[model samples]
Target chain A: MRYSGFRVIAEALTGHKGWKPVWRDPAPQAEYDYIIVGGGGHGLATAYYLAKEFKQARIAVLEKGYLGGGNVGRNTTIIRSNYLLEGNEPFYEFSLKLWEGLEQDFNYNAMVSQRGIINLIHTDAQRDAFTRRGNGMILNGADAEMLNRDQVRALYPFLNFDNARFPIKGALMQRRGGTVRHDAVAWGYARGADMRGVDLIQNCEVTGMRIENGRIRGVETSRGFIGAKKVGVAVAGSSSKVMAHAGMRLPIESHVLQAFVSEGLKPFINGVMTFGAGHFYVSQSDKGGLVFGGDIDGYNSYAQRGNLPVIEDVAEGGMALMPAIGRARLLRTWGGIMDMSMDGSPIIDKTHVEGLYFNGGWCYGGFKATPASGWCFAHLLAKDEPHKTATAYRFDRFLKGLMIDEKGQGAQPNLH
Target chain B: MIINHPILGPRDAQEFVYLGDANLMGRPDGMTAGIEAFHDYLYNRDNPAGAHRELWYHEQGDRSWLVVTRNTVTHEILKVEMARDVARAGGRSK
Candidate 1:
């Protein structure tokens, strides 16, 4: 049950590495040069890059909940750079590259297991889409492969090869994309950022945005007021609420995304496969748990728990993909809110309000884009220009009707 | 094989009705009935990735209720939880 894909991820993030500090936020701060809201993957990664790349210390990240308690901790922990969009392709490729050296670069165990990610294609049209994504990955210099039905069977040999409904047609394989330990990822970035003089303020919710004369002055948090010249809003779920304080509304709706984990068993799945035909994807964790998830909750809600239909549909898909896993027990399940956007892409751009930037609407792949999101968001925060790769993801695209919705899920997946 | 999932593995499926938004990817209404059919009814169109239907789980861990979003034709699952837990938010369309 060994897959080169799984090994690539395992070595990339979690291959035994040297020890490091157990990252913990000391205390809240009264002032900061840069105030970041939300302490999830994007927030922590942004703080890390701000210090590592921009050489800017004295940065503060304020979180409403525990550090990494947001989407970073709740995601299915899959990583891939198989975007077909013009901008998302290279940005995600960069993220995959960043994930490769996370352990060595941060000196923390992130458990990045490159179990390989395959998107199943069920038709000629889907195959074409997969090929386009593969080409995009190649253009971005990331590893991508287009696999036919026979090729897929040769690799796993346990798929529902003949299911007429969602035939095991073809797949787009990215050997570099896989899974990472959610908590270790947060700890790694947090430790690295804090070591560089970044302040991580946990349990401190920013209640208000301070803007004066068309410029950001500080953030009003529950603990105290933290002043900064530049303020970045990284809260994915409560984006509208935070941005509303600044008289701005992003093209995002808060939706719940649920995922499930099956009870641990002997090693079975060595790689990850996404049933692109439906919202089904499966990856076996190091603990032998089969982690599965799909499509966001079909409505807008701040609630963390998701509906049951998605769970049933996802489990049924898992059963079809790997008939042998039918006997495996699912252990527990959880849900997280995502700021799904009109285009099903992230909005990492400078807002009309100077000194106030937005980084939300990650749909379902925020975990994979942590590094690149921060990297580009940092570029924008420093120079105040849309990073070249994230240029199309501008907030204005929603208003202009020039949405980059490759998924064709429309503005909302449910309405579509 | 009997899949033993933490949520779905422990229960015996009870009687349920077929309610489909009957979107582009919905399953035909004339498939089958009963537990196996109910299982398919619950997930077939609301899961797998491209499903567009609503599902209701009548029986839970031990007679509790679970509602879900699912697919019918492909039997792919989307969201599953206690009927009470999935956020009961505003009905306004996003």
Candidate 2:
């Protein structure tokens, strides 16, 4: 059923009995035209666009666990398109545009809040860098503003301006960037895809892939073997293990990135703010909790947990930036397995194997790229070519020495 | 996690920069092994879930590259030693 203001009012008047499950629970089919692994935001959005835009038939999404059980629900929920590189800026800007109309497009309350985001600058060199980045963002049809120290102070007065170690100099602000309800994005896309006759099967772990003469026949799952004409894998952290079944070693590493949330308090933070000198970024949730995160645990593993050293480092950064947060007690913390690529950018290209496609290497920036990732990935799967906005996300870029090194780090997955 | 360094006292793992697989230290002589061997050394490496020996640089400490033996599954550091000593022990003193 379509949701609207009238429906909400009527449901409230009638004690809300007409509410139903967001999407249907369906069994896996024996065969499908397209099979998508991993039922997170990207997978669901890809399925939605495939059925809605491409008009594809017999689509199925298989998930090892329940939907939204991965990084889609475990992220910091911040969304922005303020990038610098030619390979990344336009694509993320497209994602931000899609995020602008996301709630209305899916008929779900994803809570796409466009309050804004500010990346704090600490030194003159950082100011120059941000100036160049701001110009790059503006050139790519995205909004950006370089704010001075006084302007930043006007926005956030509680920041530690007196800290001499990493002084709060200025910031680069993107007025259209903000946060969204991460799980709600998964739900909305799942509902939309279900309405388009896409079957979403949960608890179906893909054990192995059946390849015949370099062509994919189907996948062997926990339930049983399901045949498919084409298969696309988008499992974020499990990309390496899953792709290894096809005898392909990905240039991706799985790292655990931790996030935290403090106890509820009065509204303090008006927008998202990230520390420039350190690896801490924070925003206040609508529930009044300060949601924040820091760097990934620099190790390759599939575990969705982190140790204590990174926690101490993150706390030090937070205290160094905003000492007021020291009073708030941390309520909970969680980790998401990040598929970090070599050059700190993502890859959305076809593998050497026929009938098998891959979309991963999102690193810590996957949540913000959800909408456009699905759009471009769907375009690629339907048309058998790279999307215009995503032509730089190629698997052969590294082989050709044309790697899109966004962070300027060469072949260091964890550094990304 | 706290890693007890051989030269230094117990230090936080955050101060060290992680470089995967201590096997990276044993770079094959490119002049003799050719491109294929270099390619194998660069790309083909086992990613075990259990005990792994990796390269971690003490970037924020003594500027020493330490070969750290740690368990990938449990984040436990089994041993830590300077990479220069490990390289010399392997009879590479260029």
CA lDDT, candidate 2, residue A403 = 75
Candidate 2 local lDDT, residue B71:
79
Cα error, residue A45 of model 2, in Å, equals 1.2
Clashes of 1: 53
Task: Report how far off residue A29 is in candidate 1 (Å).
Answer: 3.6
Model 1 lDDT tens row, B6-92: 354533232332222322223334545445443332321221123433434343234434454443223345555554443333222
What are the root-mean-square deviations of the candidates from the true structure over C-alphas?
Answer: 11.8, 2.4
True contacts kept of each: 0.00, 0.24
- Model 2, TM vs. native: 0.93
Q: Best candidate, lDDT-wise? A: 2
Question: What does DockQ come to for candidate 2?
Answer: 0.39
**Number of clashes recorded per candidate:** 53, 0
DockQ of 1: 0.03
Best by DockQ: 2
lDDT of 2 by residue, A1-416 (tens): 99999999999999999999878888888899999999999999999888988889899999999998999999999999999999999999999999999999989999999999999998899999999999999999999999999999999998998788788889999999999999999999999999999999999999999999989999999999999988989998888778888988777777889999999989989999999578899999999999999999889766688988888889888999988888889999888889888788888888888889999989999999999998888888888898899999988776667777767877777777
Every candidate's chain B TM-score? 0.36, 0.94
